[model samples]
Target: MLLLLIPGVGLAIAVGILFGWRWVFAPILGWAMLTWLLGSLRALGKDAKPPGAPADDVVATPVGTDQRTLFWCEECGTEVLLLVRGTNRAPSHCGQRMHERTEILN
Candidate 1:
């Protein structure tokens, strides 16, 4: 949002310079004043906590012994135990050889 305002102010200044009008400074000045006002308001509002939002709501669940699980890698057919802090959606290792079962020929 702040990045977009810079180009607008620059264009306004350039046009103002080209036209020899002092009004160009008005836009740039207005933008700066508005930016400062909005920024201060935003800062002031930051301390007002929203309802029903717990302070620790963003915390991640700790990986525990109960979370020990197994996953199979489709790419290499390898079965691996899920590690703590491991990827939750997929197998941990890449290019692992998956276990295969077959009947032996007599």
Candidate 2:
């Protein structure tokens, strides 16, 4: 991803050199509009969502009253101990659902 920024920075520099800071908004606006147009077109595509797209939105294992579990994020090691039961939805962290750990650690 960092490599992707090199071309963007080069373009910005070229635009700044040729048009000056006062005209920088023109290229920025054009780039934004182009990105938006491409995004809109992608949204209209027939295969915009492949077969497993719905699975991404599916919640993890359901939480229940008898389950004394800790919702743990493997990404950042963030833990949330379920104290009171509410919705069965498992807590999410770092853009992914946390795993359930039934064994309470000391």
Candidate 3:
């Protein structure tokens, strides 16, 4: 993120210089370069982690009809079907009621 600021500040400084506001450009350019360097160093020091590591915080729930399931609108408590997985929580279609059902999986 800080790395991205460097070019922005540089551009601003260049523009300021062209517009005769050279004094303000120096500080902006300096800060931008400093932040960019720090960000680059931090990124370089970090190591990439492998996929599906134990430290990863993903909770996998089995998807099927076998287990006892409760489907409801998390927002309104309306009955609804667990149609798909969402990034945070399951979303309901309409009616504000959770549609819950149970069936045996083959």
Q: In terms of lDDT, which candidate is stronger, 2 or 3?
A: 2
lDDT of 1 at 62: 51
Q: Model 1 — TM-score against the truth? A: 0.32
**Please, what are the lDDT tens digits per residue for candidate 2 over residues 1-106?**
9999999788778988997965677767898999999998886784345665543443344455354678899999999987754555677799887887886334
Who wins the lDDT comparison? 2
List, residue by residue over 10-87, the lDDT tens digit for candidate 1. Answer: 887788788865677667689899999999999878755688865532334355423444566677666654344222
Each candidate structure's TM-score, on Cα atoms with residue i matched to residue i, is 0.32, 0.35, 0.27
Question: In candidate 2, which residue pairs clash?
Answer: none
lDDT of 3 by residue, 4-106 (tens): 9899778777877787666676776898999999999887666444577556445445665465445766666566444443433334456343455655556
What's the lDDT for all of these models?
0.59, 0.73, 0.61
Give the clashing pairs for model 1.
Answer: 77-98, 78-98
RMSD in Å for all candidates: 13.7, 9.7, 12.0
